[model samples]
Target chain A: MAEKVTISTVAQHAQVSRQTVSNVLNSPDVVREDTRRRVLDAIEALGYRTNRAARQMRTGRSQLIAVRIEPTRDGINGSVLDRFLHGLTDAAATAGYRVMLYTAAGPADEIATYDDLLSSYELDAFVLTGTDHGDVRTEWLAARGVQFVTFGRPWDNPERHLWVDVDGASGTAHATDHLIAAGHRRIGFIGWPAGSGVGDDRRAGWARAMRDAGLEPAAALDRQTPDGIAQGESVAGDLLRGDAPPTALVCASDSLALGALQAVRAAGATVAVTGFDDTPVARAVGLTSVSQPLAEAAAGCMDLLASALDGDHAALGHRIGPMLLQPTLVVRQSA
Target chain B: MAEKVTISTVAQHAQVSRQTVSNVLNSPDVVREDTRRRVLDAIEALGYRTNRAARQMRTGRSQLIAVRIEPTRDGINGSVLDRFLHGLTDAAATAGYRVMLYTAAGPADEIATYDDLLSSYELDAFVLTGTDHGDVRTEWLAARGVQFVTFGRPWDNPERHLWVDVDGASGTAHATDHLIAAGHRRIGFIGWPAGSGVGDDRRAGWARAMRDAGLEPAAALDRQTPDGIAQGESVAGDLLRGDAPPTALVCASDSLALGALQAVRAAGATVAVTGFDDTPVARAVGLTSVSQPLAEAAAGCMDLLASALDGDHAALGHRIGPMLLQPTLVVRQSA
Candidate 1:
């Protein structure tokens, strides 16, 4: 068997101290360019792989980022999270990191898993998703100084942590504008029951677009319901039956838009329906929807996380802050 | 920080050899019960953890299983693979194992990922799915003596390794019988294009049941297409347009059956339809389908894998040849 390469070997080969070698690898900019070049040359010559395990023993860092994913049995499958997860995995791999996936029962179980993984030195940081008001996961991790970043915006803590979120309001605004450009006056909004940060942002975008178009948003046309195709279909049916029916419906999710399309067809009514998240079903049925740049946002997240893992607290909070990428609208036959 | 407990420390505390200590933890039955108890007591007393990294240095094992999953963009989300993956993950966790997920572009890329993961010592064993005739992966792994257990049955080399598969033949047989019981004289069959082992098995089951019932299978009523709802709907529509239309339709998957239902509704026909997999979509639409015992199959895969990882190769192929669990019929409003 070949002798395993270690940092000590690299340091000796480079004629440098162990901490100098560590600095060259983790904080290259801190090291002199000439010293860093020597370390890099030695690393290349010795085929010294970055031993994440031994590095964890020395620096208390694991080159592993954990994402808590729940395997849901809901009717809506392969939603935005799946795409984001793929993008995150790709970005992490490119950054010489690996992703560890684990499922937990709820917030409490999730926190316990995080604790266990962190204490065992199995993970260096965590990636959070589905942030809500008073998110316990973020609060617990922040108190412990656990390096983490969220895929969604930090609803409660804006300055304490790092996050990458899509501009949902802008996405819905474009969707609403598209419908209005198609000569629709009665624009309706279908979204989740309102306290959700993402949902509300999307609804506000539609309202803003309506007001800009000199149209008063009617309460009779606007409806909020649990996210699902059936619920969307039923609510859309009810809204269409109302005295002032909407000629165009803007849904917060593709699942809801799917239901609205079915309702419109069932009622033999023609209406432009726009959905968020250009999901597979939306593409199949040709539903106009907003598509988030998940890969770019994921790349942003990895960049922020890499800075956090390197102990760049200032870069995370003050310099970079939260990244918000714009989502583009995909026009299809349904709209 | 307190001194980290290692295997050598545990061996010294237990008054046993390092090999014996390893056997006690990995394959307890190989060691005497009294010696195992002593090692367990020492492990508890010293709070010893079997460091997977250090163990790999000695035993060349990573204690991690790799499962290649494709993040498909198909409309049929939460397909059978997702359920099987969840079951596998849960079963692996229960057995003190971790699962590593990786994505690949295609079969060639998947094989390359397996090779890379194995060479890096990042994965101890692999779990294969979607096996086909002359599967390059099984051939490659078998030639290298790499430890692996397939979730799908091996079409080529049955005696080389371990596998667990649900009995598709029996599942379709029961579905066919259910249709017959419902007094459907002429039942149509909708399935994927031929040459697939699973698809062929299911088609055979329907034929067997029809033959057993003293009914000749009608060739004209049988249709084969790619697995999709739209294709299923279109093909079923074609089959119904034939001179002798079937009173009921038996689809190979829920996606196909969903399309069949839509076609039936459009035609205002009362043809009972049955789909397989019984996924969330099937349950939502009340489509009667076949449900594979995924949890049991997953448990079997893990058990076989555990035995293989423990150096008990005899337990895999001889004692427990490829496990074929029976799938049951899930009756819903459609059938």
Candidate 2:
């Protein structure tokens, strides 16, 4: 077997101390540019390999990020998750990190998976998504002093933890305002059953928009249903037959909007509709929807998580901004 | 901070040698039940965490599988890839292994990625998909003497590597036979542009089934074009305009099948169409298609890869069967 290259060999070749070689690899700014270049050249010449496992044992850093995903047969928003995964993966790669995907049946399984992964591997940090109220995963991770950043905000307790989420309320508010401006006063909202952190936030946006326009957001105009095409179609039919039918329908997701469009076509009625996530289905059908700046959000997520993983938690603590990103309205013929 | 527990500590506590402690952990079957139980109890009492870094340096194993996927926006078969990923991940998790996902720009970029990952981390093996003739990734990995298994069988160099793939020919043949059995002898075939290994294999199946039935497989009855719903619709329209319009269509993908359906509907004609992959759209619209046994394929892949990862290559070399899994015919309303 060939002799493995070591930092001491590179140090000796470059006529520098071992710490200088280490600084060139990990904290390049601490080393002079000429010295860093010389050390790097020596490393390349000798084919120096970083003993990541050894460094991990000493520093407790793996340069691996754990992203928990629900490998369900029917995810609520498959495309959104795919896009987020893509963005997060690409961004993590740019930061010299790799993503380890672990699937769970549900929230409890997710917590257990985290525990197993943390103990089995030296994972630097975790990226949590699909968060809801009183999330046990978040509580468990926080209690164990494990560093993690939730893709969705900490809805119940947001004071201590780091998080980044697209502002659902802001997105729906924009959509509702656009519909109202287009001369639609009786607008209805279709969303998931109330109490979902994101769903409720989106509903609140519509309510706020109506109030701003000096219009009473009628209770009868709002319908809450589980997320599915059939559910959306069924509830939309009922909403359309009410005493005062809504002229425009705003949904918490594209799935609901597509269903509402089906109902509209079946009833031979013309009503503008808006969807969320701006999934491929929305674009294919030309439905006006809110498109979350997922790539930007991912970059932000990598920034926060990378800082923590790089052992710069003090710098992360001082950084301030709304981690909530504003989703833009992609106007189409649907609304 | 507490003192770090090691195998030496467990050995002392269990009144056994260090090698015996290692045996209890790695090769438990060789250790007597009583000794194994004693070692386990000591491990539990002392909270002895295995030093993965030390073991990795000793064994040069990372227990991580690299599944390279092109994070493209318009994946030719996104849903198929997604299902395959789900299967691979779930099966890998069962074997106490984790999946590390990395994205690449193209085939050349993919090879470069494998090199970078191999040099940086102690990745045990790689899972290659979307392979083509003269694949550079395969050649590079093979040349470097790295362990890998291609999801798609090598079209050019089958004997030089390990692979697991769905039997595309079997799937299309089954679909053709079903259509023929349904009293539709004049079945038309739609597939991607010829020369694609999978596409050609699928087309050959339709030809084989027709030849077996003592029916002439007319070249004029088949259409080969790029994969897209619009293209499928356009080509189906062209095929339907022929003097001998087929009674049914067997498409290589659900996208093509959907387009064929649109053409049939527009022509005010009734015709059955079978698609491949049985994607969600196919199920929603009730299109009969061939459904690959992805889970089985994934299990097979994990079994082979796990054995290699476990340093039991001798067993893998002797195990034999057709790696090409036969897909099943999912009967839906369309056909």
Candidate 3:
């Protein structure tokens, strides 16, 4: 068997304390961008394989990853959850990990979910999603020394917890810039609620992109629509009906953009529209949108979680850039 | 510690032989329906649980469930593959199983794929989709004593092996019945290649419903051009150009359905559109369609797989009914 290189090896190689190496690993998003790049470079160069949390898995108990999925009640389980698992399962298989589904009724079910995973040695980590500001789950996990990574950023500056999230700012930037490049000036944005980190980041990106282009974005206060296309359409409809409507619209989600398209068409407006997450709906409609490499993100989580299983929480945080996948401006007549 | 239950306990409780119980577990689809139901009742009544496959798991070895994700990569990993994993993964997790993604470069790569898994201890079974007649992969796995199932059915007979799939027949039936209820007599069908397991089942249901209503079914051939929406739109256009164009159209997928709607709108035709799978695209466009319970189907796969893991391949073949899931007549302006 090959001698596994780990955090200690990387620390030694970088001529730093293991704690520093851990910090670099845990909070790369917070690390100065240059410092973050240096640490990541070292990680790749050193061949430091993540140490498996050997006890739970070595005990011959199948290690389970608690993947909290929106139950069928929410339309999320159909395709969104499905795509995530495709990446997650493939990555997990490589590390001899399997995912157990945790379906929550709502925010209240979150506590019970943690309790269930805690009781079982079968689970080594939790992959949380749909988190918001002031997230109680992150607080609980941090307090109990549980191994976890919330898919999106939590409201609080979570304490050196491991996470794999899309750089929503960049994703939104990609969408906004595309519109600007296509000779769209009076562009409007379809925003999500102010609570989510992704929503805020995306909104910020759109605003910044507008400011950068020497253009004034529409005075929309980020339409606080819920997840799904219906909300997108409803909000876009309101924007389209108003006098002095913008020539282009930006949505936080591809699903939402679909809604925006309907709104744009229904109001008999010749407006262009774009979205984020480059889902199948986006591709099917040729909606220009940013694509997040979710499979790779899911794989990165496994690489981090496996190290966390070794009792080194600080070795798990990974803040990779949302892959700058080229968002092709599919010039369908609708857009 | 609580005593674990085994196949023998289930057999004894069900008043059946161990082999009968094994057969019931291995090929649930083959067992008498009444007997199978009784066995399930007995297993539940006895609180019997199967042994976890921890033997191979100790060394981090695993049963590679060869998941065929037909890399249909047009820069996007296949969406259908993503959704299927939502169920396949959750089910595998419970049995301490893992799925290895087998990205077939093309149909040629399909035949020798299992050799890699066999040598790597990465695969113990295969879950297939987009299967056609004379698939060598299915034949290869059957010869290797590897457990197997197909999401899509093959053109061959029942003697080959086992599989559990979405009830496409019911999905199409629901769509057809919905259109018929909406006062549409001349209903057309725009679909994929005919005799495809997915295509055939949906067509069968549509035909049955059309015959029942004393209405002639529209052309059942693949009207789609190679590309997605353009194909649907052109087919729809062709159908509209026909002497007796249908008042409604039943499509194989939401993508096709979306195209049909675009074509209908583009031609200024008055035909309503209905589709299967109820993909997010269907909802966004408000095209009334039948939705398969993807989550439930995922759960069903897990249940059968759990039985298969227990060395009961017979009971693993039980058919889960395709849920109609209250297909709404989304009554949008087009429909």
The model with the greatest TM-score is 2
| Best DockQ among the predictions, by candidate number | 2
lDDT tens per residue, model 2, B140-194: 8888778888888889967868888998988999999998999998999999999
Q: Which segments of candidate 2 are over 4 A away from where they belong?
A: A1-41, A44-60, A157-159, A181-183, A262-272, A283-288, A311-322, A331-335, B1-41, B44-60, B181-185, B241-247, B261-271, B284-286, B311-322
Model 3 DockQ reads 0.08
Residue A256 deviation, candidate 2, in Å? 3.1
DockQ computed for model 1 against the true two-chain complex using alpha carbons: 0.12
Which candidate, 1 or 3, has the higher TM-score? Answer: 1
Instruction: Evaluate model 3: give its lDDT.
Output: 0.63
Per-residue lDDT of A36-133 in model 2, one digit per residue for the tens?
88987887787663444234434657778888655634433676776787788889877767888888888766776775566556678898877888
Per-residue lDDT value at B182 in model 1? 83
A-chain TM-score per prediction?
0.83, 0.84, 0.74
Identify the CAPRI category of the predicted complex in candidate 1.
Answer: incorrect
**Top candidate when judged by lDDT against the true structure:** 2
